[model samples]
Target: MSNSDDSRARDRLAVMAGIDVDNPELRRRLDAISARTAERLHQPVSLVSMVLDTAQFFPGSHGLDGWLAELHGTPGEWSFCATAVRTGRAYVVPDATIDPDQATNPLVTVDGVRSYAGVPVIVDGHVMGAHCVLGFDQHTFTPADLAELQDGAAEIGELLQSYRRGDTPA
Candidate 1:
């Protein structure tokens, strides 16, 4: 997309609006979304990550090691969610080693991450984060897989709105 669009998207997340990452209720809802996403996509890792200017917070996640406890989030430079959020579309990287944009992404550590597919989680008409799945093999997702993820993202959007409205994410 255009730089203007990127800027507009960047301006919209409203992180200052305050997302309570530690909210147990929010975590429960996000966990369900992440688990379902992983199962539906047949990937080893699934994450509902908020792509802030500073980092990608894995509020809802699967497949993360203990490193996340030590570090609240992954650096933006190493965040695939950052690129996906900027694109405003589903970012499909079947093979990180071959994808120019993702080849250097830290998620592609040696035998760790080889595939990724993510849908932008647009909140209040702006990009806030991504609902994504990752794997250790070069697995190309089908169109149905994308549809499933997009549908899941819609649920996350609803949850975000509910959180903003001070309602239960359910």
Candidate 2:
């Protein structure tokens, strides 16, 4: 479902994710986290994305240059993170080109993101966003991969809660 049609719980979590909060240190920390996750997962991209009604904002990201990862955000329909939120679980697509569910996704067709692994970042029992890794080459995700992503998502969730609590990064 679209963020506009999302549950109040989801909306609350999004608010808790501090989408409007301007914390440069937090952004830097998140970006570093994304970089680490990408390296750990051997993926080309990793992102801490907050889903919005019309778009998804990336406070943290790796493997994306100014070519497409705009400050304003990409369209929500183009976001795989939205799928994680919709499922409220880790979503994996081994090969977007072959997966019926993801084959036609714009991110796959337009940007050539072939494989994806995303874990929902929940706050107050609602999915606010996702910690995601993307690959340009197709690679099946194993249970272990899912578990690692879950851990990363958990860390993201904790950091988000701290942000909401006004805990500044040192």
Off by over 4 Å in 2: 1-14, 17-21, 165-170
Off by over 4 Å in 1: 1-10, 69-72, 165-170
User: What lDDT tens digits, residue by residue, belong to model 1 across residues 21-123?
Assistant: 6788888788888888898788988988888776788778776665764564788888888877877889998989889988877668643689889998877
Candidate 2: C-alpha RMSD after superposition? 3.0
Score each candidate by Cα lDDT.
0.80, 0.80
Cα lDDT tens digits for candidate 2, 1-170: 56675567456655765543457777778888899889888898898888876688888887886556766358888888898887787888889999887889887898788999999987666787899889999998888778878888888777776777455543
How many steric clashes does model 1 contain?
0
Best by TM-score: 1
- Output the worst ten-in-a-row residue range by lDDT, candidate 1: 9-18
